[model samples]
Target: MAVSFLSTVPNLLPIVPVNASITSAPRYPTLGATVRCSKIEADADNEERFKRRSILTCFGATVGLELVRSSGTFVEMAEAADLIQRRQRSEFQSSIKDTLYKAIKENPDVIPSLLTLALNDIMTYDKASKTGGPNGSIRLSSEISRPENKGLVGALNLVEEAKKEIDSNSKGGPISYSDLIQYAAQSAIKQTFLASAIRKCGGNVEKGNLLYTAYGSNGQWGLFERNFGRADTQEPDPEGRVPQWDKASVQEMKDKFSAVGFGPRQLAVMSAFLGPDQTATETLLATDPEVLPWVQKYQRSRETVSETDYEVDLITTLTKLSGLGQQINYEAYTYPVKKVDFSKLKL
Candidate 1:
């Protein structure tokens, strides 16, 4: 979206009354003129300061993007993105509660697969180096939850779950971390599209499109596809590409994205597309309180949470927030079925 400014007056002084006889005329400033001048000065200062703030915010967004790309945190981004999708879909499906819970329980593996796909896409094409080489090892779990790693924990949770499932099903076979990473990466990219749609409908910023794109791209997972035949460079690039959240501006956001080959219109469109699902839980919570507590407890146990947790927590938090349906009715919303236009997407 285009950044808007409050109205301001011109700073140039008004032309003096022209008189051939008098070289100088009595200069009298009108009351409106003085007020306008003051307003103009204040507006100028505010715009300047806001510009700086925008740069800082953009920087913060960029850093989030880098963390996901470099740290193999695609799974976390997917989780966050899925939460948004679930919330959106819940708005249309009548059996959303059961569906969400069952899906959460059944496909713990989905997130990891998605995460891996996203990571592979980014690292494969971008100039940045892959973090964990065959010899260079790092703990994916710990890195996924770092403060600098905002917007990625959700998908990572899926990866953790996938590992557990693999261990359980293998009957003692070694689980493949590499495979999980590839899957999670893929899921993250799909989630970006889903999250963008929710945000367009006015969902919360915490689960918004901007964060999804920021985290996904900053980490280099959401980059454009290039010729696959290019040779792989073993060396890693410098780290300045990632933008910081608190110190970024709109211009900075535009600049950084442009540097990666995205334009202002594309950035704006993406920003308007995704967001978190805020009301999904509230509806569930309002419907059933007796079963809500257990759900909330289960959700809190994980370092990273998901829509399933939110669904469970909704029931739990609702019970705690308000009494059972004696006076309130908490029915889950239906899920949406309309597909978004993918052809219009820039990223």
Candidate 2:
């Protein structure tokens, strides 16, 4: 028998009330011990080693038990297990992406909120301290209640609804809140691009999907999709980690962006996430000497029907944003399946 890690887990975490507030919270905890934010950086070599170790570990524990009693050879069983994991992960990816697309399409109002939720979740990183980034701490009531995260509870609730559907269909276990939030944002952005194409085509859904699919760069979204297995933070992040978006000055916004290694071009391209109106945001940001040129450049790209330049930049930025301070579990979505076909055996 293959080792089954499948177990009944709760579909969603218990949500804290949106109105809950925790004043006087520290921005980052200092419990007389250093927290290593960069300790688990994901790299190519590290990922390869992790995958190899996981496969070998699982294979060792199960092969002996099955090899003695079963007809399947060790190589065949191991290959079957690896194949099952890959197939399951790919199917889950498609399933969850479909769920997100349906959720966003049926209720287009959630797009801005979803983008903001994802943005707030990621912006908590302080590169100087190397702490906090897209860990889903924003799901905590205390984190979302902050001034910067105002009007975001709706987005969180929407994600919770999607989570229920996703977890119900998941064979492994519940999807992590951290992964869901970032992925929902990615889906929302793609939907936004689709919406633009649909509008240009006068609400022709078929043509819009085809046109965008043909014109859109799958490589960009693929970059974001390849990253998974983000764990959630139990405690709310330290206060003041996110910027007060509605009230922050242009320079203040610039400083925050710089802290995360973003430049004027990124800031200009991501203006839609900063506010409801991308054009208005560009107009406001145009006042900044450093940001004006990029804003103007993207505005010109917007003149084209496809807005390909803007779409490419947004996808690239979002892909990077979703991974800030992340330590991915390359095997998170891989679940077990029947290793041997006993029914085929001639008894």
Candidate 3:
């Protein structure tokens, strides 16, 4: 395991891979045109937006991680993740931006709170699934009031207030809290991304130039381009009934993360991935000391001058997770990934 990681990770640094195939592939530009990267390239000024949505490609993967644990089939997980992400409230993104920006400015001292808010809503408890003889009608706070949700108090408060504001000002009714949860994570990622880009580009990227970001394992790993038609009218998720985390072991973590389709390799990568960036993993490390080494590896790999391991696992995991998103897409669409022949093409 160590060798696989040590060897594979070093070569994968800088995350973003060049999709040279797309560029080199045969294609027409326009009338009497051959090909140029500009023909298919998106404008650089819009890079931030692309990064936001592309980061969102992880939405399905993250939500799906929980479903697979409860005996979920790939298609079932795909359906559920697709449904949840489709309904995400864009309003929550604003709050997320604020929270993550604060984290960037303040650093680890404030990271615990931000990470707590970002991760609390995503514990995989569903509202609609809370059915029994004695249970009352599921109100908005049903799951939010649960013991499992203790970590999410701040996130819940934020959403509750945001919902009320939206209801008061917007033409439409308030957005669903479930959707808002997904958006919170989305916003955090976007803010972190923009901040990182700014710092790397000398605090000011030119009007048209590359935004420094690793594309991860496979190029387009985090890019989800398909549309999801699942409606927002569906019921919220039922509460997730998971075991307590106290005294949990590394093997236990492996078993649990495996349910979400992650293997030791992924855990290895994710440890190095989530550990350094989010700093929220500190909450987990406090309870699960076994992951300390992996987290340390992530730190060294990311910050060390060697450049051998810098951000390798992060990019690798993102790319792999993007592939997982595509896998879910494949199942949800119930169609094969369409193969394109560049040789024969019109417009």
Candidate 4:
């Protein structure tokens, strides 16, 4: 039966035709038919893709190596730049300090005026709108001529002269009037501290200065001085902001101080800036029930040798007042100057 079945098959045959159609559908079930390419064409296409991928890989490796090499130098360069900036700032501040120190020595009368300039300028700050502050706007002719800012022109002139000299000596750009005004106030406060010590030392200026330095809070001025680089406003601030010291009532004074975010204690601590005498200021402010206690406390503290409470509060309050509505310029003293090499020049 097996031999008969084999004979009936006639002959053994290949499963596939010799000349199969290239466009024929797949024998098994498929989603779609496909176009078949010749072996040579497929090989060429793959070679082209490999060439592009190799080129891209080489380019990427070269860039990555460069970045890795440069990363080591970037930090060092940044540190060096920062050092230069700090050094320049220090030198700039020292120059100004020296010039002002000599100028102040020549004219000690300007001390009171200095504090007045800062006080009136800072008093223009309105907490609600955040419009004004110690921005040297008090230097304007219109502003200075106002009743609230009377007698400030002399102080303005003193700083203006210093500005001229400072500008001439500056390696960086000129110092703004805003920075000068606030810095002068800080210097004035230091002078006052020194003056007090000097008076205690039998009117010997040098001895007084030495004694004051030994009091251990001589550096309190740093609280105000460290926040440097203030900007000036071109136009004058609106009127009715500052207190009219000549005629302002106690309630009016309290109200004005309240507008600028100060309490009775702050008002009492800052009495010296309002007028020449703290005792007289306390007497006038003592009429108010709310402000009387602070006035009395500072008055008592003023009698002590150190006057620690008064000085500490004054410095802290003045620092806050000076910073009101100010946007500090971090690059104020970091200008890079080019030096001329005379030896290399032909002329």
Clash totals for all candidate models: 73, 1, 12, 0
Clash count, candidate 2: 1
2 versus 4: better TM-score goes to: 2
Error (Å) of candidate 2 at residue 42 is 59
Error of 3 at 300 (Å): 3.0
Candidate 4 local lDDT, residue 59: 41
Which model scores highest in lDDT?
Answer: 2
Model 3 per-residue lDDT tens digits across residues 282-332: 346535455666656655554433223434454444333322211122222
TM-scores, all models, native as reference: 0.26, 0.75, 0.40, 0.74
- Candidate 1, residues 109-186, lDDT tens digits: the string is 444333322222222122233222211011244433333234545644555665565445432232344333432333
Write candidate 2's Cα lDDT for 314-346 as tens digits. Answer: 889988988999898867888766569888999
lDDT scores in order: 0.34, 0.77, 0.38, 0.73
lDDT of 1 at 88: 41
> Per-residue lDDT for 83 in model 4?
84
Q: Ten-residue segment with the worst summed lDDT in candidate 1?
A: 222-231
RMSD of each predicted structure: 25.4, 22.2, 24.0, 16.9
Residue 8, model 3: Cα distance from true site in angstroms: 66
Clashing pairs in 4: none
